[model samples]
Target: MGGSGWRKAIRGFNLCVYSPLAAEGGGDVGPPGASYDPPAALSPPDPPALQLPTPTQSSSGLRPRVSASGSGLSKRTCAICLTTMTPGQGHAIFTAECSHSFHFHCITSCVKFGNHVCPVCRAKWKEIPFHVSSDSPRARSRVNPVNMNRRHAHMSFQHPLLHNLEPCIFNDDETLDTTFKTSGVCYNGSINTVEIKTYPEYSAIPESISTDNFTILIHLKAPLGPRNEISSKNVYVDAEDSRTHRAPVDIVTVLDVSGSMSGMKLALLKQAMGFVIQNLGPLDRLSVIAFSSTARRLFPLSRMSEFGRQEAFQAVNSLTTSGGTNITEGLRKGAKVIEERKEKNPVCSIILLSDGQDTYLLSPTLHNGQHTQPDYRSLVPSSIRDRTVHNVPVHVFGFGSDHDSISMHSISETSGGTFSFIEGEGAIQDAFAQCIGGLLSVVVQEMQVRLECLHHNVQLGCIKSGRYASWVTDGRRSGTIDAGDLYADEERDYLVSVNVPPDHHETHLLRVSCVYSDPVTKEVINPAAVELKISRPELVGSQTMSIEVDRQRNRLQAAEAMAEARASAEHGELSEAVRLLEDCRKRIFESEAAKSGDQLCASLDAELKEMQARMVDRQHYEAMGRAYVLSGLSSHLCQRATTRGDSTNSGSFTQTYQTPSMVDMLQRSQTFSPATRQSNSKMRHTLSFPARPKPR
Candidate 1:
């Protein structure tokens, strides 16, 4: 009977307690009413067969106690109420260690009334702490204790639960914790958890979200790209469907007609201009400014609609070559033309083609200070001088060999324009096309980047934007404005090609931020933010991408450097040659680093290295040339001594054959040996006399 009663109690406990708990907690725990007391028959039938206490309704008219166990009556036992246990249905149960149970819902309400212990035994359940199981699901679901503590500290003043209820909530005081989740159990007693939901209040974004005045960002695609086979038919196909506001372009073509540019160079210039004119649409306008001794306008700000092909052809064909190169005057004239047309167009440009030489004016004044006469020739007029002063970009093209490329490059760089060199007449059209294409391709406008510092504790350093980019770094601490240092901040926006990462499909809003200092105020701004939306080009079917000439530009720059170094060496400017060579070396190094393929990079590296080695060899050759000349002079002097029969007259010979100190002898001791010197001496003795009138 005792064993049967024990079996019956165990069965009831398993069914009532373990099953309910396991079902309620998603199969993670056993049922609640698992404990049961032995039956009277099994316990010697003592104490009038003590029965488990039935649940009693409390003052709130709800069942409070449900079950009982040994040594204690069930606090409240209501089978009907207990059977209704379901999640979110208000029915709840809490079992004590003594196997006494009560309604969880009722108990919570009772505890709020300052009840610190179980009502039956007056035992403090709060103080009776239970160890959390390592593999328990509840323990696993709880927020990490350390993270919770950090979050609590992060929001010590504000309520954690309240803060997480909204979106777009900027935390002015929350500190990011870096050391919270290093190790140990996830949920200890120290952590707090904050639950954040999506923000519902931010309903609309303003069309112009920036708080500052309008800013413009012009993205210029790189002027060059890989050389691949492209079909000409696809070149004219429109790849983008969007219509951009095409700004009026004011262009001044400053052509070089110096004596050096006699035939092929001059003809190529004419042909390239023709190509440009043919490609211009009706809405576009053009201007032709030619320069020689003085600048002259062949055509000024004529719309393509009114521009006569015959007149343009006549103007170009009539160009004559004469005199010295005057680049400064040419640039000045181009700038003046654009300045005159600035009101007519927002975009103004100058296209200068030269051999890269500048000649100063010989006369002090002309027409009583109205004009000055140039010494040799002037391609650039004096009127364009103000453009450089005003920071206008000047695009320059160096044509043919014997051109002054260095000054032309300087002009382009100083003016924020591009510098290109045409190796031969054949490349002129291609170079012109690239320049024009770059000028025409403008899609984005009024672009600005705003940065907000998210991390305040870490000290930030100087931030570098992309090459040829600009940034703002000062003014009010939180608001956006125009007044700021150009190079002081990490947040910057400028014109640049958006290079899509591989396998990227959709456009994304990227917030690029970095910490930086304010140059004027010396305040550290953390996590400076520059927001940008990047999208892939909507390429159309069978469209031909325009060929970029950036690679060509780099190669051209490299070649130009080499040429400049040679010229410098020829002019006895060794230091200048070394400087130019070093620049060339650096460019080559960068090119190698930027190349995509190993084979191609290695090939280019080898070529550049060879060129560098050749440059060194050329310098050695120049040195050797000077030595050879000196050696010839020395040999001539020895022959003269033998002719005068002064073999022993070392003193007289020394005075007579004294050479200039400027001459340096070759350091070839082996070749100029004593034996060779003696042989030369004997030969001089045999042939020194003029054959005594041929023994007449």
Candidate 2:
């Protein structure tokens, strides 16, 4: 049948199947028969008795297995296979730079499969020419074919083929089935086995793995996914080396003193401030600003060494909440303080504590002159409206649910600072401590990731950042180059992840470059010409894992859009509501394409499509209703104007007046109307008015 015929048949099947009872029976006929009587009891059968298997003792009366060495005892387990091993076995086991390790045989098998290193450690080994050495231990230990197969069966019986044999030896149990097996061996000769029905415990290596006698695994898991192996040994030692420079920072603390910020909220803010002050080193300088309708500097900026502890404590304790919230004023004053201190201090930052909203500040006015009335309640001046223009950065900490997170995020984004949301008062100290610790360890002054795509045809999307700019690419047939700046002699590293179209044939190359200012010489340094090549895709099954991730992301997007539509409806934004709903429908459709097996996705696709059609119809009617109202209002306004002119006996009366319909249409089409032209003329005339009369 054709596609249309199949659809019709499916719809007909759905309609016929109304209820389970109706579908099960096609009309009743006769009454049910009587229940059958119990059959006469036959001679009672002999009771089946439980029989236990006789235990057979081995000739030696003990299992023959190698015991773990005393020094080999450890809690380290293979992360991949999750098996516990004795320290000796673990020590004998070789690990690559990537921290992956395995038994010698297992490593050999992995290498034979075009994997050049330990599957778990991901260590790359030098490719040496193959030559048979008579004295080689591996050659001497090679077993005959029969013995090799027997060993393989024994190993398979003791432990599943999936388990890694690096740190533990397996022993076979004749009583248990092939599926049931042991999982771990301890240094004290203790063994643990798990049944097939039980959940497997993943091996977690608590201690750092050693890098020796193994190869690193550099191949990532999948296209644009996380690298399969990273050498733990390659990570920088001496954690202190991560910091490049040490400069004293000048900090300004802006506290909210609104009525709402009383009691626990205010007390916690003070406690957190005290913790920060105590943690500061002698070189740092600090200032305090408290705000509520207006901002007041309670203390001037003072060096950590010279500041009196009594005075600082008094200033924090004396703070009280009153009046309305004026966050804009507080921020402006705090910025000024930072600027004044910038000439003396090399580093300056502002730490703002509040709920993340702008209730204290008025919404910005549009520049269009249609409305000439000015709202003097706005606290943010036109000069410093943008936070990016400021020299100092602002870090925000939100307390309680009442805080506006979007405004806080915007403040952080503009000032190139970090924004953190605190769920409760108890978490205030920890959050403040973490922020202050990060500030003390600040290494790179200005770090940024720059991507230079080799494939010009590919389009780049927006790069997002919290504390630093991290670049990720999302497109087909693209190569990415990530570069960043660092502080002088500051050893810094960034993880650059990029997305590219899955290629199955040709190799793709990504070029990277780095530029930074030298810390000692204070001169700019540039390093370029770093390139990486990605191999072609390897087809796995019917669906690529990337497709699954894409589908999941689409589902999340749909859910978010649905939530936003519901919120917009509550806020009386009908247009925005309808738009969000439409976006949700599109996302659902796109998700269908990524699902495995077209037949399985068919039913869900049909349901989603039907829902979308219904929503579109409803939106259409709603839009028409809105248009009708606008048109009626416009006609009424014009009629009123005409009537007024006629009553005045003006012969030159024209039927033209501003209405909601005209305004909406003009906004939609981005066109100017005759009314707007007249409004502009009036605005120019008003601006040209003579100077205000001098006061007597």
Candidate 3:
């Protein structure tokens, strides 16, 4: 009330506790002018219920005074409790910006519980007058029956690990539970700021499921909220640039310097490495590994200081093509460099580029002098044979048509990374720039999701979590999903199929919980679990469906179709691949996503059409279409937006790369000079969308 923004000379009063029963009573608590005798000493043992005395007259024998500032107190009633207010008594009137007046205690009690809006007009209050004392009767009385019911449901059983954690509620109901009214529903305001919400495709399933199933879509994201200054740094995140803090990255560039990369390929690789080295700041560390028949470290893991950049330049320039391609060795050596780093940065990854198959694993029996046809199965690299290379992701780049895309795609997918197909002469640098851009903008790391069956009758089914790894545990009653690192504002959708049995009782089906580490604060956050409940109504009622759930289902189905098409094309079944792509496109058009004006559907439709056009013949698919399809599918499965097709076609990666002559001049003139350091250090590309088929 004392702030400069105060517009009225209104009196503020100490909040008084009111009984819910009194408020619920019909307007005849007593006849007009009737007074009830008060009890002797107020006892704190029971809830204090202050009843408003009739405004006919006061005990002091003073009549009420009327003022223009407020409608006379004798004629007014409290909006919340619907009780008369007497003038010159203890009660005071409070007015909001909308000119609606209420009892001081009623409005203050509402605002104290985080309801910053006027109860009558619902206008938001910018500045509240006084602080709420936690030990006040009004504050204690705010806990109504709604919150008590929710507490009973939430505390049914608590795990030792998550005993005191708050429960995440759906909050669509208007009952206004105390906890729901205080904090925004989905946002728990927990240690981790990321918001995780789950929605079942169908709100209510049939009670008698003779042979029926349901797929639930769970979404997780870091909400873009108001900006706050934490520790002398603004931690606010925006939609476009939501990086809370950039974690220092330790990256290894794995180059395949085989005979095939002798010409423009080698030149482009060096240029890409040069751009990467120039772009890194002093906080980031880098290493270089080049491989031919064997692999060796070209540059040790060192910070990107002035001296370190110069050393990296020399190491990149010394690269020469020789012997055969050894992609396995290159990836192994790259992973080793990161694991052997003396000082570990919070974020670490390896960038592997290969233009041919791994000859190290190809051993053809030599009956005569010439070699027989190599076993196709042996061509699959051993790096991904164990289903994962290492904890650090190896973002593999398959250069040109000859690169072993199956192995490259598997390597990146298995290691929780993305696969980029460098088809054009100059796309190597663009791909590397895109990869490095994602590494620099990482916001959350080491994310894990745990989904448990809340009901014994409810059964768990397959969970489609894209490229992230997931496994079922405890006799299929529980499961864990390894989501890995997420960039700023990135959202990953998971479609979990579940089976329900015919039961008379309504109960929760599953509970989802997320655990992640904030890259900036380095704090481990474990948010409360969200439940997916279902009801068995005897007579089915009209139920509203979530469009987002349908859209995610279409996305996964399209990804599966793309995978099937890619496999068909790889096996020389061009006609079948084209048919599959066409079918997927039609399904996308017919899906709810298309009707909802979702951009993802339009993008997928365009990509599927282009893919169908390219799948005309086996020769075309083998030349350029295979890698392109694999890369596109990889982008969709990982839920990470990536640069797809030619850089000219995809306007997202339009930054021009320096030519060979310009690269030489940049290296000689100290490219990352003080003046240019700031520009180079700024992240060029910030991934704004989840993994999709087209560039964002």
RMSD of each: 42.6, 35.2, 27.8
- The lDDT of each candidate is 0.35, 0.36, 0.57
In the predicted model 3, the residue pairs found to clash are 639-691, 640-691, 641-691
* Model 3 ranges with Cα > 4 A deviation: 1-192, 206-211, 222-244, 363-390, 501-506, 519-522, 534-538, 541-545, 651-696
Candidates 1 and 2, the one with greater lDDT: 2
Error in Å for residue 696 of model 2: 77
Q: Order of candidates by lDDT, top first?
A: 3, 2, 1
Residues 395-459, candidate 2: write the lDDT tens digits: 67656556654455456545555455554454555455444543443323332334444533323
Question: In candidate 3, what are the lDDT values of residues 1-696, reduced to their tens digit?
Answer: 001100001111111111112322233222244322111100011112211111121354221122334322223554443455656756667877766666565454344323365443346678654654434453334222111223233322111112011123211111112331122212112233667788877776666653236778888875332122111111112234332245667888888888888755665466567667655654578877778898776545766543344445545644556789877677766665655444566777888888898777654567679777644433323443343433577687888888877777877776767777776645656566567756765667789999999878767789888878899888878888988887555678888877777766475789999888866567788877788887777667787567888888777878888889988887788899889988988888988768889877887787787778768887777777877788788788887655456544652232222222222222322221111122223412110111111211
Q: Model 1, stretches more than 4 Å misplaced?
A: 1-248, 361-391, 444-452, 458-460, 463-696
What TM-score number comes out for model 1? 0.38
Candidate 2 stretches greater than 4 Å from native = 1-246, 306-310, 342-346, 355-360, 363-391, 404-406, 455-505, 517-529, 536-696
Candidate 1 on 1-696: residue-level lDDT in tens?
111010111111111100001022221111344432321111010111111111222354321122343322323442211222344644446666644455453343233322234444445564322333434554344221111223233322221112111122112212222121232101111011111111111122233231122121321111111111011111121324212222334456788777777655564466466555544433345667666666565544554321122234334544556777766666665665555553443345678887535664433466865865433323333333334333345667766444554455545544545555454444455455545543432211222234332222111122222223344344211222221212100122221222223222333322333332322123344422444442233332342211122232343344456556656766776567667757765665565333533332333344334334434545452432222222122212111110111122221112221111100011111111111123222321110101111111
Better TM-score candidate (2, 3): 3
* Candidate 3 TM-score, true structure as reference: 0.60
